[model samples]
Target chain A: MVDMISMPDDSTTAVDRALDAVLTRLAERAIPRGAAALALIRAASDATTGGKRFRPALVVAAFDAFDGDRGATPGLWDVAAAFELLHTAFVIHDDLIDRDIERRGVPNVGGTFRSRARSLGVADDGADRIGDAAAVLAGDILLYEAARLVAVADIAADQRVPLFGLLDDAVLVSAIGELADVEQAVVPGEPETTQLLSTAHDKTAVYSFCAPLAAGAVLAGADAGDRAVLMTVGADLGLAFQLVDDLIGTFGSEAQAGRDAGADLREAKRTPLISLARETSAWPQVSSALALAPTGPIAVRAAQRELHESGARDRLVALIGQTLASVRRRATELPTEPRALIERLATGIEGRIP
Target chain B: MVDMISMPDDSTTAVDRALDAVLTRLAERAIPRGAAALALIRAASDATTGGKRFRPALVVAAFDAFDGDRGATPGLWDVAAAFELLHTAFVIHDDLIDRDIERRGVPNVGGTFRSRARSLGVADDGADRIGDAAAVLAGDILLYEAARLVAVADIAADQRVPLFGLLDDAVLVSAIGELADVEQAVVPGEPETTQLLSTAHDKTAVYSFCAPLAAGAVLAGADAGDRAVLMTVGADLGLAFQLVDDLIGTFGSEAQAGRDAGADLREAKRTPLISLARETSAWPQVSSALALAPTGPIAVRAAQRELHESGARDRLVALIGQTLASVRRRATELPTEPRALIERLATGIEGRIP
Candidate 1:
């Protein structure tokens, strides 16, 4: 059923065009402001490039499923592009918070500016601060740019308010989720399982899944009931995706995940897996290994081995499986086209679990 | 003549109501999210409080001047509130970029979080990072909240797009201005007078004055010619206001300005005053004093004395006067009501010069 509509590739192309249009307009605006403005715009362009466009895909899928004349609607592409812009904004800020200078094996916005400042002979700390400021400004531009796109999108007047509301809700919820994540890191305690799962849901699921799906439904003039169903399905899918992502971050090969396998452990990030592992018998060895100086490869291996041997890995995998099943069940209430898309996305996420 | 419309007090009251309404709506949304979300909401409330409501006053004054109904429009209040929210967001982010943890003798949003984290046993740098994260999230929320208020406000549908565009332009321009400021600090070169003044205009004037006035004109359904006149007046007023602010930051008493007088010299900020001072005979003394470690009272006094003795302070003050005269001349092109308001506002700004 999903094959009837050629997804993702076509959707990705349309969204790219939409994004290009936005950048062109921004460039036109920046040119009059001078070189500094132009440089910031260029940095914005670089930061937004090369993402998988996952959120845009969900927006397109839901919009296509709900609207009969899907491909004919150019506004759908702008809507998709807005989600991608929002995602880029979040990614830039997240990198700044993590003090990470790289993303996707390249210099992120902060890293790029840090390098520029260093080349100009700024001290290390001064260069880092400049990089942080640039990242903040870049994120600010994209954040408002996303709202501006939605406000100007060629949709019905009545639909604009709801879409704006959805975007606002998503930003607020995601910020709270991020705050909780940061708090857990510095507050010196093990987060409860429910708190950990809720943090994952709020931080990752709401903006990435729920809002995009709902925004698509709103753009397509879907009824409230159908929109609610799609959002619930998105919630389940998003939670499952985050859990699987955490697993990949901890145990998957660097080549497969495109990130360091030991990063979460090195940072002592409290995830659902970590929360569960804290109660296991192998926790002592895992804790002691984590305590070793330098947190080298030996410690990471011992921690991973203990997690696997204690069955925490299996439990988390089971949790992910249950979450995906819930997505499938909730998706049944949506229309057939969206239901198929949701199930397919879930399956793709499931494939990430080792 | 300005007394015919009862000036800022009434406008301030209306703006307060609007800001309160925004906080009320935000609190209602946060209640269900948990304690962390509520803490964020509280921080936002604190951050938004106790400002002179300067931008909101501009919004209300311009709106009332254009619209005959005056105090009858509720949407005007929301519009005013939106500008205030925007201002608060900028202030928070600016403080973060400047590494300032205090504002107006109080702990800012970042400082509040940093203190909390420290009390909870986090080390200095870790607490600072946590605080930076909180400030980022807080600013993000207020930034979008500003847009959301504008989006949901009760106004003609067509007016919304232009207002959104105006807000978008202001945000982007202000960001570029901030980027230029950061770049100048790290790149280690004397900035041209034109560049310094341009940065001030972009960083302070557009969002602070032009956007608020233009937004008010839009809400009141004013003609394009009238709107352009007000924006031009805003540009001049904003430029003059910023020039005066820099002068005050350099030479005014702390009790009068409610800020540390020597802070700008200590930071070696590149304002028009500093740019002009670089060309004077006293440049050597000022430069050497600035290079002194600790940047204590002696260095600040020597720098300030050199600025005055070298005539740089007088030049900046004269520039401010000329800018204000230009604003008054431009006001002649606006309607009588708005013209009165603009002249009064410009006079108040002039009073700030030391």
Candidate 2:
């Protein structure tokens, strides 16, 4: 019955619906003061941490994938929204650390605050300081709100204990990855690109992929063994998604990228393409290509050629495909969710231009 | 029997006992690996939030003042430590926003990380990124630790309800104050010094004074009214402490001031003295006087005179005295802590300079 509307399977749609419901509640009640309300609204509006809301889709889809009555637990929606809120909080902090301003058109929370402060007649320098501080707290508030939502999930509180513990552990691990990424950029040792990607995976994949999916699965009657599979699948899928992001960051159009082309080159972000590009034997061609690459189309095209000649891009894509295959295998086994829906969402993202 | 040891009423002894226990435990723990350890240690080591252990003192004093039986609870120490942890977290993040750098001769968490990143072989730009990121997480780690500690407080879970709720509320209020301070600084408002101080009171005093002292009093069995009185006391004391700190920042000898002098001017931090100094008929004299203030003995003398003449320092001292008197009067109905011992400790700080 749940399979009829592809909308039911849409992780993005499901998460958004759930998140909106939760946010609506916050808007209606959480804060009464004008300033506090505005701060929250500003933070909630920042979608920087979220990517495609695919993880959230997994949360809802995983529940639908179950054998239980489809609409029985209306309360479960807020639970799923909780994950999205947590994800949003994570992204807020991430954007700040990345220093790549602007997300989804509006300035990220930090930038937004800076702009808002300026509008309020704050000086340039002081605005930045104020913006950053407010943004940090805004993120903190979202995190707390996320916890509050999660705590009220319809599932048996005792059963959700492990999930709560895991969520906290994941928070700690993801933070470590961010630290490592920042530290790596500062240090001289050109550690293997594998290390950088691993940091990305640790910081992102498990939580975005496995946790949300497995949590929904757990609510839907999945056991410990099922969680292990989901984690592996999620890690692979997460890596693939990140590589796609890196590719897009290097090659997408100005409006599409939401950041500068080759920002990684200037920021020295350790991307698979850059890691491979720097090591090319066609050294002069690659360097000149990198230097002359002005627009996104040109840079991406140049990067694409360099990658193919060096065989790095192919290897990276092949690696991505392999990871997706494992993810597909999990999707196939987990019939609780609409199989066609999960497949469509995952595969379709790889093809999305912007 | 409880009086046999004659514990001083000074906030430090209580805080020291609480802090020493926690740090010792932290040193023995696994530290959770990689960047997590750094995050945790940096949180524990923050000096701006550092105090003479006053909060833990307040908590204990509250317990004493309310006739809280020493033998009643198993985890009173943990309770006191929890308040201190929360207070320290507030201080660390506060300093990050202020960007003053030096706190008691050691570089702040952000500054320390930036320098150490390079020393650890991280590159300069990368180190800067790492530092900001660390400061952000370090704040979170402290916040997380405070929650964990408070969760274990010895009070019956039901009785601890107010404290639990207070802990959460404090985070929100503090964040609002922070946001306001940031916005206010940028806007260059002509807010009277009292209004400016009120922002500080809400952000710093309410939690620094009202919350911890009230938490202590609650545990010690004080009535609601008693808690209110303690808040008034803590508020003034906190204001005084902040004012003195500001004076020290602008005018103290480098040896005593630590960190960067004239940091307030550079950051445009909204301190009471700065606000007052900005005022006055001797405007150029005050401004030029500020610019010429040296980092050592001469700087201290010049700063003292400027602050004194501007009337800001005198106002602050007067406010502090008033608040303390009120706290003393309100404290009468409540059971006394070791008053003689506390008075002795207070006397020691008396002639040491406001």
Which candidate achieves the best DockQ against the true structure? 1
Looking at candidate 1 chain B, the ten consecutive residues that score lowest on lDDT are B1-10
| Candidate 1 per-residue lDDT over residues B1-354, each given as its tens digit | 122123366677877888898788888988898887887888888999877777777777788788636544567788788888988998899998988899988999889988888888888888888888888989988888887788778777788888987798789889988888887776776779998899889998889888988988888888899888877888888888888878877887887557777677777777789888787888887667666613588878887887788888888888888888988888898888888888788888877777
How many Å off is the CA of B38 in candidate 1? Answer: 1.6
Please give, for residues A119-206, the per-residue lDDT of candidate 2 as tens digits: 8777888777877786677777666556555544455544445555545555655666777777666677675777777776767776
**Poorest stretch of ten by lDDT in candidate 2 chain A:** A1-10
DockQ of each: 0.67, 0.35
**C-alpha TM-scores of all predictions:** 0.94, 0.77
Highest lDDT against the true fold, candidate? 1
Among residues 3 or more apart in sequence or in different chains, the pairs in candidate 1 whose N, CA or C atoms overlap within 3 Å are: none
What TM-score should be assigned to candidate 1? Answer: 0.94
